[model samples]
Target: MSVEPLIELKGICKNFGEKMILNDIELNIYPGEALVIIGPSGAGKSTLLRIIAGLLAPDTGEIYIKGQNRQGLIEDKQDPIGISMVFQQSALFDSLTVAENVGFCLYQHSKLPERKIRQLVEEKLEMVGLPGISHQYPAELSGGMRKRVSFARAIMSNPDDSRYNPEVILYDEPTAGLDPIASTVIEDLVRRLQQAAQVCGTYVMVSHQESTIRRTADRVVFLYEGQIQWEGKVQDIDITDNLLVRQFFSASIDGPIRVIN
Candidate 1:
């Protein structure tokens, strides 16, 4: 039997004032698959992720999480359900220690005791290869450390039968603004998380680094002009005879994707 799609988006349309950001976007994320989306700036990649996270409402179209409609969940009011995101900036609270930041969601949502939460938080930190840094504040950690903390927080939770293991984890520029070594570290952590979770959670990320995209993405969706212009695997990328794909992959300035004056 075929497994059901973990997330489905149909005919999604979004606009800011008169500018249309996304138009007729139809996509599906299956269980245990990592799908990476690569696109230039202002191509609606982040907006699409926000819509899936229920942080932004599309003017038209439908979003489904595990077959349940996500129309009513606003950005803040949406139940945690089984989704999470690691922002580009590693948005950790400066005042809170690493443990507190990782366990913040559990503190807010679950009635579990503080002791239990701390235990889980420590485990998550160790899983991400930062075992004893829980007492340190975000200000005390390095850029790569902060990203790992954010990643730990995103996946810190019980994977029980009743609660859905994250059906999707949307990563917004996971490797942006980092040194080459740091960027590789973040990419490797993503792979580790996928394997450790053992759940069929899909990953959809927006990134500019060619190395990260090649390492993590099973399939690539190239967005341009607010639409997907090319979709293919990493190997096919080299042989794709599409002009737009070639131009973007080669980082050539001459292409259908033009720089606005």
Candidate 2:
């Protein structure tokens, strides 16, 4: 049986002054799937993500969460219905230690005890392959470590509390600015998270990294010029004859895509 979409977007549109960022976009993200949105720097990939995260309001369109109309609801204010974001910049608090940062959401939103929160934090860190650094501050951690910490933070939740567990985790360039090995670690962690029964949820990631797209995506959506230019299963990307897909994967300069210099 086909699973119902966890999140759905319809007639989505956005404008920044005179320039359009997204245009009548439609998408369905299914449960237990990793959907990756990809495009170049100016392709509005991030804008699409922010709109889905409810960080920015769209000029027009509707968002459905679990088949419920949510266009009128505001994020954070409405409690986002089990949605979380792992930012491209890591977005960690320098003043807070790893443990504190990881548990920040739980402390703010839930009535969980401190000791239990700390235990959950440690488990999340360990899951992301970064154990025993909970006491260290974010500033002390390397770039890769900090990214992993953000991943841990995104996945941390009370085992007994379903409200604290995100049903959709949106990753904005989770592997950006990391070395190959570090990138691989993040990729593996993403795959693991999607399959893990304890934390499995529908995930949507926006990234430009070729390796990241190849390694982490179960489905791929290629957004360009304010629309979804192409989409298919991850394996279809390599063999698909779509010019944009071919040029993007091959990194060829001779295609129809023109680079601004």
Candidate 3:
């Protein structure tokens, strides 16, 4: 039996003034699937994620989440879905301690007591393999630790208990500046989060590291020249002979994907 897509984008088109970013893009994210988007810079990878998160509205296209048509302005001012994003830079507040940072969303969105919020924050931090570091500030932590904290914060739930599980998690260049070891840790965390959530909630991430993609992605979508040029499972990547894919995987400068002068 075919599973219903958790998220679907049909003929999605977006542009900034005259420059087109996403062109007739169509994608479907099945529940519990991890879809990694790979592309050269400016190929609209992050833009697509933002669009899916409803942070940006496409010029033309349709976005459906959990079989509901999500087009036009959102009726609810809050985020349409239980979606969270982990930015590459681990955008944590310097003033807030790690626990406070993780619980910030809960405090703002729900009426939960401070003690309960702290407990949930600790749980999320432990889930990310960083327990008892919640008392420290972001500046006091290492880069990898900061990223893990951000991951924990992104998954933190509100006290009102609306929905503890996120419908989707968007990761933007998750391992960009981290070392190899740190990158691997982040990759493992992504997989663990998917398993723990146990929901059909989709995971869509943009990354440059082949190892990270292979480790975390169930499917890969390659974007080039402002569109998705190739897509397949991670295992098929080596066998597929698409020029763009070959060039990308090889990290070769000589390929169809050219840098503008």
Best lDDT among the predictions, by candidate number: 2
Q: Write the per-residue lDDT of candidate 2 for residues 1-261, one digit (tens) a residue.
A: 888888889999999999999999999989788899987778999899988887888899998888777755454455446788899999999999999999988888888888998998998998888899999998899888998899888887666667667888999999889999989988988888888877856799999899999998989999988999899999999899989889987888878677767
Better-scoring candidate (lDDT), 1 or 2:
2
Candidate 2 ranges with C-alpha deviation above 4 Å: 76-80, 159-161
- TM-score for candidate 2, please give it: 0.95
Highest TM-score model number:
2
Stronger candidate by lDDT (2 vs 3): 2
Cα deviation of 115 in candidate 1 (Å)?
1.3
- Global lDDT of each candidate: 0.84, 0.87, 0.85
**Which residues of candidate 1, in runs, are more than 4 Å off?**
74-81, 159-165, 197-200
Q: What does the lDDT read for residue 12 in candidate 2?
A: 95
lDDT of 2: 0.87
Give the per-residue lDDT digits (tens) of candidate 3, residues 1-261.
899887889999999999999999999988788999998888999999888887889999898887788866443444435778888889999999998899888877787788898899999999999988989999999999999998898887663565544778889988888999999999999888888843324689999888899999999999876788999999989999899889888888898889665
135: Cα error in model 1, Å: 0.7
